[model samples]
Target: MSDRRILPSQLERMVYETIRDEIVSGALRPGEQLVEGRLAAELGVSKTPVREALIRLQRDGLVEIAPYRGARVIVPVDDDIAEITELRVCLETFIARDIAARRPTDVLEALETSIAGSCKALADRAEEQFVDRLSDFSDILAEACGNKRMKKILGDLRSVLHFIGNSSRRIQGRAARSIAQHEAILEAIKAGDPDAAAEATAVHIRSIAEDCRKAQVPNGDGRLPGPAANAPRAKARTRARANR
Candidate 1:
């Protein structure tokens, strides 16, 4: 047997994980500028790996790069939340129904484990771990629904969720409330009630959206637009117009 050594190939991946963790943990604030040279210096590496890692983050939708202004952590706006919520409600409600009807044993066990992990994280006040496990509930259902496309789409959506989850957790009682909602979805799944599970998932998603919107605060460079500012523009359909 030969001993394995850390290769140059692994540096990029290592750098990527470190930066991604900082981003997701809110150690690196949203919309914070990512300077490659500084990151390389902090990680004790050259700029090459740092640059590569940032490109990966950009692909994950966690970072945004400009032509000359450099890269910054994504600060999701209200529109982003609304769009994500709508998509998740549509996709996950379907997943909840499908997975509930099928009731795959392995998937059920995974859901149970996720719930337990989240519960422990909540008691310990481990916000990062709590969010990871809580997010897993939707992810597990997405995977078990037998739709690869949906799974990948939801996976990509997890990037913006880290910021939202961190914000939502700071709101009083939200952590416990989220756990209860997850339990509701899981209980409905266990009882083999597709409609109940689906409805539960829809309710869970909508409530989270509402909470995230409330939790956002003003930042240094900008503010996440409030619901009033981000309201979806709807075409007027007045009765007077109908008379035409």
Candidate 2:
């Protein structure tokens, strides 16, 4: 005796999650255009739901829409990345301090479970799941942060940071290093050392920005400096020719 009808709001939320996940996972890519008619046809829904979902995405900071230009994924420039990194460092460091002072046992257990899953995913070389594990790990920290508004702020930034995090994973030796960093932060939290935990959180978040910088490719993905990024390599190639 359950209602089997799909509500319009339900449909919109589903479309929102699908598109958001696609964007976050890099399938949609930064600055990729989102066409309403096309997406509606593809999702077998009407344009209304797609349009509404897009507005919600815009509210989430995941998309930018113009009156006529349509919608595109938000592309984070280097300055955007730096500003976001600093903000996260501050917020997460504060969360670490709060959690350390409180030392909630349930939160600690949840973090332990998340870390175990991440470790296993890494061991099995499951790249996609590993990124999800990273999100879960951050979520656990956000939940334990002792402020609802702070948790929401972190959650709002999660997708953007998640994309940047996946970009960071492309760096050589970064995965192991990331796992180690997460552990360091957790260990400090467990020890109830607020200063240690805060420092670890700051360092871990900062490392992500560094890794993302190292992982940027020239003229691709909008990380910038890309226009002239190849000049040095080109110059090196020219030097080899001159030597010959």
Candidate 3:
């Protein structure tokens, strides 16, 4: 990639995309500070565009801007994550049902392709890409549902969840299990079984939610506990809702 400083408009676009991608991909982990000067230098751009980009990212709930701390990635609280996952389960299950009812062969093929990629990502132990690829798969499903309102809602929900932190690495075999679920959904869709697809998708999301519940808690803790460990999660959720 070119390290050259871009023009004003290009710089703005690049800065936004770069920071957003880093945040979503988990390249910049949640709670990691975003040093404007360093980022500008790294991207070979001036701090002006970098600052603007940070503001934009803040609005997108991808970064938190504090008086002394500047900008940092947002991490979602247990409740917020749980809520988002619940919303996703509802929306995605509906999508699977609608798509299966319609029997869209092309969309099913696309989802299968995404599932294949997700399986490979899991096999390679690439958590970041795995989550992102899975998100793409989800987008396809939502789009295939043929409901604009649902798509918009799911898109906004995804933006909030992405900022919270990539949760794909929560369990060892979670990714593969997700892929299997996708396959099951695809099969249901192929069979023109809307009810079965919806059931499978809901089960898949619930399984992930269970895994996240485990991952978010420490070894011994069953539920989210302690103000100390929970502080970051609370802050992230507040920032996310505020930004939205």
Candidate 4:
């Protein structure tokens, strides 16, 4: 752990982003322990900021801290993902429809570039690059809609979804399919077919959500039995608690 002086705000942001990225990348899987002492040492910051940032993340739906137990990475279940996908379908479909009707040339071009980058990253098996490019595609669609409320909502939702397990692992030939979907959406927008574009966007998000759900454990139920020697200890508190 490197020790360096940092402002209060910077420390908090740094802690938040570090933990968030770890969760998003699945480096910290669901239900994994987040020991304050360990994290503070790793980040070279006092536990105060780390604790505060964790509380903020809990509010943001990224972590769950139970009483007497430490924070644990959250994994959305099938139901949770379905609801999220439905919300995304509604929001993004509307954006696609609007973009199609308005035909923003620059936005379309930006989306094309993102799709190309995403395809290349997928081919190279670069997970970070693929995620970044996919994000850019979403950003372009939201910006094209010209709705501040929609943009903020989508951005926040994207953050939450980032923590979900990646489905890219199962999609053996997903890059080509993803590119085709994007091309279809873009073509519809270019042709000024709002209805088709909206439908296409809805289908795309649904497919991604389904893939993510498949990667998760059955129904997202993630409980493990305690060690044989600790069976008695488990009877008292089956669930973990927040740390002091």
* Inter-residue clash pairs, candidate 1: none
Instruction: List where candidate 1 sits over 4 angstroms from the true fold.
Output: 1-5, 219-244
Ranking by lDDT: 2, 1, 4, 3
Distance from true location, Cα of 5 in model 1, Å: 5.0
* Tens digits of lDDT, candidate 4, 18-63: 7766666555665678888877766666789889978988987878
Worst 10-residue stretch by lDDT in candidate 2?
A: 224-233
lDDT of every predicted structure (CA atoms): 0.76, 0.77, 0.70, 0.71
- Candidate 1 per-residue lDDT over residues 1-244, each given as its tens digit: 7956556667677778678767766666667899999877667778898899899999887899999999998876789778878888898899999988988899999999999999998788675577779878877887787888888887777766655666555456777888899999999999999999989988888787887767666646565423211111121112112222
Candidate 2 lDDT by residue in tens digits, 100-134 = 88889999998888888889988987766777786
Worst 10 residues of 1 by lDDT: 228-237
Best by lDDT: 2
Candidate 2 residue 168 Cα shift, in angstroms, is 2.4
Clashes of each: 0, 0, 0, 7
Across residues 1-244, which tens digit of lDDT does each residue of candidate 3 receive?
Answer: 8766435776577667776766665556666789999887666667888899899888877788999879987665667667877888788888888888888778978888888888887788675566767777777887777789998887766666554424444456666687788788889888999899999888877777666555455446443322211123333323322332
How does candidate 3 fare on TM-score?
A: 0.75
Candidate 4 residue pairs in clash (backbone atoms < 3 Å): 68-241, 68-242, 69-241, 69-242, 69-243, 70-241, 70-242
For model 4, where is the 10-residue window of minimal lDDT? 235-244
Candidate order (TM-score): 4, 2, 1, 3
